[model samples]
Target: MHIGIVGAGLIGVATARELSRRGHRVILVDPEPLSGATHAAAGMLAPVAEVTYDQDDLYPLMATSARMYPDFLAGIEADAAYRTTETLVIAADAADREFLATLAEFQRRMDMECEVITTRAARALEPNLGTAIAGAVRIPGDHQVDPRRLGSALLAQVLQSGGEVRRTRVKAIEEENGPILRLAEGEDLRVDHVLVANGLNAAELVDLPIRAVHGDVIRMMMPAHRDHLITSTVRAMVQGRPVYLVPRADGSLVLGATSREDDLTGVSAEGVFQLLRDAHRILPSVWECEITELTARARPASGDDVPIIDRVADHISVAAGFSRHGILLAPIGAQLAADVVLGEGGNGPLAQSVRLGRFNHSPLEHSTRK
Candidate 1:
């Protein structure tokens, strides 16, 4: 099969690699690959810390993808620089403590490996923790990865595996006899299958209910003397706002993020202030770190905040709306997209949870090729 992937972010790259490895000819189309949400993401694989009480169905998919990370990275030829570090979920005050305690209890009931510990124990694990913390929970299975490195690796592997990557934007997609991709350069390329993995842009090709959820992230480099001040990922609730600090391999830290619905402008002062303020409350030394980069990107999200993986047409499959879990869900999402393209039924619970039919109707019916 000659598959045309419309985006080169984490999901598109992953899908391209998966399809290429399976002996399919893949052409990834993107004007700026990896410059989208994947670039700004912290790449934390913490399904436990990310789980919300209302979204229990997403947990299984996230956990499955997190568990598949080691094998996934090993299979790739390039070094993605994966890191398996436990995450410490901390609370800044009494109210936050009670909220986390309840969350920990809920995770425990779900048979997740979560331990509620005192602030002293949390401080013992991360000595740089501020004294104002109320409590913490240790989710040992959560981990982290460098999404930038992963994207580079996937792109390299796809190219090495005889796949083509076109550095061009897709103007439109029309299906006359087969799927014909109209490029921004005024060219049309026909393919056997098309995967609309273009994040929020997928909605432009197909009438899927994908919206952009914006988030602001900051990258900071720790001082040479205090390089390893915090070794593990720290997630905290500071004054009812959620923030996290993920320490990278090169003595840098990623502090983020502020989740908003419809603000697509550049980075805002309030978002940066909130991130820095909450991060400092968790680790005071963060205030002394040098700010390297401040980025704002929108994650593709559905109305229900779950992924959309379904074959809307015979040769067209849509895989978008990963929301904030794009990095974590890449492996499984790629597999599911490939399965859909190959006409293999992806009937798993995770696949069913994100199937397009759940939206009550699909726009593909109106857009199908005659």
Candidate 2:
């Protein structure tokens, strides 16, 4: 089968790679591939640490994708992107500590590995931690990854596997004889199946209850003397807001992510300041790092915050609304989408759990979601 995937973000690229590996001819369509959320993501693959109070349904997908990371990266020969270092989620104040403690209790109740540790114990694990922390929890199963590296590796493998990447936007998808991808440039190409793995832009092609949730991320280089400043990922709750620091393999740190549903598309000043301020509370040595880059991207968020993966049309499948967890969920999202387009009859991909039909989706060719 020949498959056309729209929107070459991390999800689209991963889906293309999955389909290509499954012996399907694939054409990737996007104006800019990795420059979207894939480029800006901090790549913390922490399903345990990232859990929240009201997202029970999302845990299964996250855990499944976290488990799939090993084989997923290995298949692309990009195992170097996966980092096995564990995660430490700390609290700054008494209130923050109480919050994390309560959350940790909830986490443990769900059979997740969460150990409440004293600040001293946390510092022992990562000697460079600041003393200002009030409490901490060790999530040994949580880890990190390099999303940019994974994206580049996947894109390279797709190209090497005889998959075609059309460096243009897909104007529309019209079902003439089949799913015909009307390109913004060059001639239209028809494929047996079309998958819309685009981020929020998937809304332009297909109707979904998706909105843009923007986040700002900062990249920095640790000083020569302080290489590997913190060996593990650091997450903290300062006051009531959340912040995290993800260390890369090459002594760089990713301090990020302020979630906002505003119109500011570029990097946010307040967001960067909040991240740096909160990060300093966790690791005071953050000021010693050289600022490298600041990026902001909008994550496609569905109404339920869980991703929507389903066949909207007989020849079209849609996978979007990863929210901010796109980096953690891409592997499963890609596989589930592949399963949908391949006409697989099994229930392996949890398609029933996150399909558009959950919204009682009408036929795509007949109507669009309002």
Best of the candidates, lDDT = 1
Candidate 2 lDDT for residue 113: 94
Please provide, for model 2 over 1-370, each residue's C-alpha lDDT reduced to its tens digit, 9 standing for 90 to 100.
9999998888989999889888999999988888898889999998999899888778999999999989888856568889999999999999999999999999999999989999999999998888888999999999988999989999999999999888898777888778888888757888999998888888878878889989999999999896578989999999998999998888899998699999999999999999999999889999899999999999889877889888888788888899889989988888888998898747753667777766655547542332
For candidate 1, list the clashing residue pairs, or say none.
none
Q: Alpha-carbon error at 92 in model 2, in Å?
A: 0.6
lDDT of 2 at 205: 85
Candidates in order, TM-scores: namely: 0.97, 0.96
Cα lDDT for residue 320, candidate 2: 89
**Per-prediction tally of clashes:** 0, 0
* Model 2: lowest-lDDT 10 consecutive positions: 361-370
Per residue, candidate 1 scores C-alpha lDDT tens digits across 12-108 of 9999988988889999999999999999999999889998888977999999998888878986653446888899999999999999999999999
Question: Model 2: residues >4 Å from true position, as ranges?
Answer: 360-370
Runs of candidate 1 with Cα error greater than 4 angstroms are 75-80, 365-370
Residue 127 displacement (Å), model 2: 2.1
Question: Where is model 1 poorest over a 10-residue stretch in terms of lDDT?
Answer: 361-370
Cα deviation of 261, candidate 1, in Å: 1.6
